[model samples]
Target chain A: MSGDIVIEAKGLTKTYGQAVAVDHISFTVGRGEIFGLLGPNGAGKTTTILMLLGLTDISGGQVSVLGFNPAREPLSVKRRVGYLPDTVGFYDQLTAADNLRYTARLIGFRLAEREKRIGEALDRVGLSEFAEHRVGTFSRGMRQRLGLAEILMKGAQIAILDEPTSGLDPHATAELLTIIRRFKTEGVSVLLSSHLLERVQSVCDRVALFSAGRIALMGSVSDLGREVLGSGYVVDIEAEGSGLGERLALVPGVNRVEQTGIGKLRLHADRDVRPEAAAEVVAQHGRLKFLGVQEPSLEAIYTHYFAARPDGTLKEGARHAA
Target chain B: MRREGSAFNGLGVVMLKELADHLTSIRFIILEIIVMLIAVGTVYVATQQIKDTVAQDPFLFLKFFTTSRAPLPSFIFWLSLLVPVMAIGLAFDSVNGEYNRRTLSRILSQPIYRDALLFGKFLAGLMTLAIALLVLWLLVIGLGLLFIGIPPGGEEVARAFVFLLVTLIYAGVWLALGLLFSIVFRSAATAALATLGLWLFFYVIWPVLAGEISQIIVPPDPRYMALGLQTPGTVVLEQFLARLSPSTLFGEIVVAILDPTTRALGPIYLSQLQGAVLGAPLPLGASVLIAWPQIVGLIATSIILFVIGYVVFQRQEVRA
Candidate 1:
């Protein structure tokens, strides 16, 4: 709800040997917002996340988490930041309660405080009943919940999760989104990076689109949709004659056109030109069986921005295109 | 900010948790079972041998007991040799496994320092080795009493106690070595392999190979070689090659415990030791005094290795 920044990075870069994994990228997440870092695989999203948590070295640039420099003040910064790695990798031999208890103790929680926190966190993540079970025997979703339980036990002000819902089922993913939503309501700023755009869009208030090592486009979901397409509609049409409306719909900036039947067509075109196109279709071809406008999904917008780069890198040029 | 005392509390927490981890770990369980089996098998075989030997010639006991001052039941000798191997096995994966499991990052993220992590692991390892050693010692003493019917003299007790101290310190060296290897090598399997390789090299392979090298380096003259070659060659060659091994340093300590008449040569007079077979097998006090440097060297080596590990761990990157 507030515009206050929880994490801020400027010209952040990380390079391993000859390859630059995360180029000089910059972004900020506001307080209490679920900020998603959306990118395809090998896009440096995880690298950027690590840099924010002070887990990885910063080859160049500066980063501050909760107003403390992550490099110089890692302990202080880490005190208020909880990180969930890609795979979770809990101590498989330890019971969930034991694992959480161990982590809680490490973060300097009082024994009494940790006891309560452990119980509450496990309950919140819906693993309360399975707290006594070894993590090795837990299902993937249960392990994820335990990982969340560990993070929540720390009582961190910010949560940085890398691909938290990657392997979860639809039900588990929904449960995870609910937990993240609850954290957001409690004023915990979350930085979630995943290749799942729909999941990110559902949980996040804002998103930073990453490609290669750079952030290509960053803004609210609606704002990015508006900026990229300026109100585009995906129109599906059914005609009687030669599907000529679908062929003529291939003007510059017109995204795509597909024939659904002998005369039916699906049109992805600019909003301002849709009425003009439809009018021409009526005059030139025939009567239309159906014509409607639908909002552009995040998938369509993501493709429109990412597909331009031959290498699929979302750098400055692709950012401008978006 | 929270108080500073909590940081140490965090360390205590890790220590306790690791202790539990060790208790429940299959590695520790399997090691305990193996060590107990070896100790029981060894003591049983030794008891049977001593009984049969005494029956053959009752006076043989007098010769065995009086000729060498090394306080026996000879169980001490076997115990010393076996303890280090067991200790190394228990600790070889302490740090390396954490790296492999990727749990080090999660654990270190807590308010504890790298030093505390190493210290906690080392302490836990020492405790485990001590416990195992304790069980073996008790069993050895009990078996000795059953067969020999001697409760052991004050000198015997003193020597056994000193031997235990040496065993603990020796085990510390291995624990430290394993930890250092873990830190240097990221993979647990690689660290385990490297540690076993080093153990084999130092304990078995090195001594044999060094003996062969010594023979080639200082071969016997044909005129003097045949009649008394084994005696003079063994004396000169062992002294020279033993100096190359920490195990040799330990072997000297063991010899001094059993035979307390040999006098220890000082550092300045180490050269004088070339042709001289140690006279008046050194007193236990004198052996410890002379071997203090070697003992300290092993301990210091351990400390230095762990310190390097700590530094590497502190600088490593932990991903989210």
Candidate 2:
């Protein structure tokens, strides 16, 4: 909302007869921002992405990509925004380069420009050595890289990736996240949907948690954690001390202090109370052994937000939707 | 709502890419071998027999396609079946193969309409069929010139060219049928089976069914049959029902185009034939005139099939 909005959905909805797949969800993706759509498998993330790309019809409401109506001016929207579908596949019989060549032709790039762009894209993804290999022989991670390379080759202003790291190993997921971060650095808006919240948390700047065809929560990780978990900061105090818990409770911004074990305490605060708590611990003649603050992860935020509602109704709803 | 840009923007690229794939595929190579045997092998044997027993025949060169030795039907007989087989073989997997490969969604997500992909595939299949047919036609012509020393007349060339063109249209009909089934069914094997099943129904089953249906419709007039003359309208109804199959329509067209003496495609009354000279070959134009309705039927059927495919593809979801 602060910067140029690349994707703006106004109550975008999709239905199959009586069942609604995406139920009037609205969100805006700012330029050069990594926006994550995090939820379980049937949370309508992929459906939302498809509606934004105009690959599927919006049964109600509307969406726009780069200021062009996706339902009406789909070609213009598709021209500037590259989409990497979930479990993306290519012609297995064709070589990697030949596959890219076919896409380049579809993008209407001339011969000379196509080859050069393909070379650069493949090299950028570190797939230059495998350009001549048949796509049937590509590993899962390599295929994802190639999908990303396609978005890069398109020179798109926005990239929509669905489940980019679903089947990848930890090392591969790390590498993929690096390339995604590079997209943000290069000023390309990234709108990615995934169920793997923990792995993708490091890359996404803002995220929407979906459940049963609706967004349950939408904001940055820490903001949602604060609103849901009552306090966003969790600081650990490891020191040789006495009466530190009672003393640390009076520190500014520190909400409360608990004695975990002998001479150890955990502090929940509205903000970073590590500095104030440390000062207070030392003021009581305690020798500080160690101190650290845990970064709020999306996984904790997602589970805590959903679990806070009594009766486990949303979880049951999510399971039925799946 | 109006979608932006031309639907035909990437039509040529998809057409060329698919064309290249078809021509280089192993399936096409097998088809090409069968075609060589059917076109060249059949024509060569027929030429040997035609040369040995030649009388004062005016349209002798046209006989290259019509003449048959024992144990082999005329080239026209095999061709009516071969053209459809080749066309179906080329197109049965055209749409569903993309779905199975998971490439259809990716291509559709590009800056092109669904029309370009479907139309390009149909065009590419037609072009590939044309190329194979052209090569087969040339080989048969070469065999004719090699075996039969005398050169064919100008009218003979015109008539043979017309047969080639009709065969292409005939190929288009089956290609469209296969294309339609490819879109209707999501699996390539299922689409192939469905198209082949329909082809078989038309090729073998319908002709017999047509006769039975026509008999039920007109009831084979016993009063007229007592005089040893066939009943009127009965034969017409049978032919009409039979020609519903594109195979029958194509066969009739080939008969009129290749055999100049084919005076009619349907039943003819003795009174209607009384004024015509016996054993006289009609001009190429007259023969075409006789086959005009069947030719138009073949063309219309192909167009209808292709339009159905286009509509279904447009409404389909891009994801597999």
Question: Looking at candidate 2, what is the lDDT of residue B286?
Answer: 97
Which CAPRI quality tier does the interface of model 2 achieve? medium
- lDDT per residue as tens, model 2, B1-320: 55668989899999999999999999999989987888777888788888789778888888888899989888888888788888999999998888887777778788998889889998999999889888987888888888877788999999999999999998999999999999999988899899989999999999999999999989888888999876777888988899899989888888898888889877776887988997689999999999999999999999999999998887887774
For model 2, what is the C-alpha lDDT against the true structure? 0.88
Candidate 1's C-alpha runs over 4 A off are A229-295, A311-322, B1-9, B37-77, B184-187, B215-242, B265-283, B315-320
- The sequence of per-residue lDDT tens digits that candidate 1 reaches over residues B195-285 is 7788667877777887778778777567666665454564477566755665766666655555554456322245756776654344457
Error of 1 at A295 (Å): 4.3
Residue-level lDDT tens digits of model 2 in A1-322: 3579998998888887777778899999999999999998877898899888888888988787899888898888888999888888998889989999999999989899999999999998999999999999999999999999999888899999999998999888888999999999889999999999888888888999988778888988778777877676999989987778888888887887888877779999889988888888888999999899978877887788777775445555654765
Give the RMSD in angstroms, all C-alphas superposed, for model 2: 2.1
lDDT of 1: 0.72
* Chain B TM-score of every predicted model: 0.76, 0.96
Let me know the TM-score candidate 2 reaches against the reference structure: 0.96
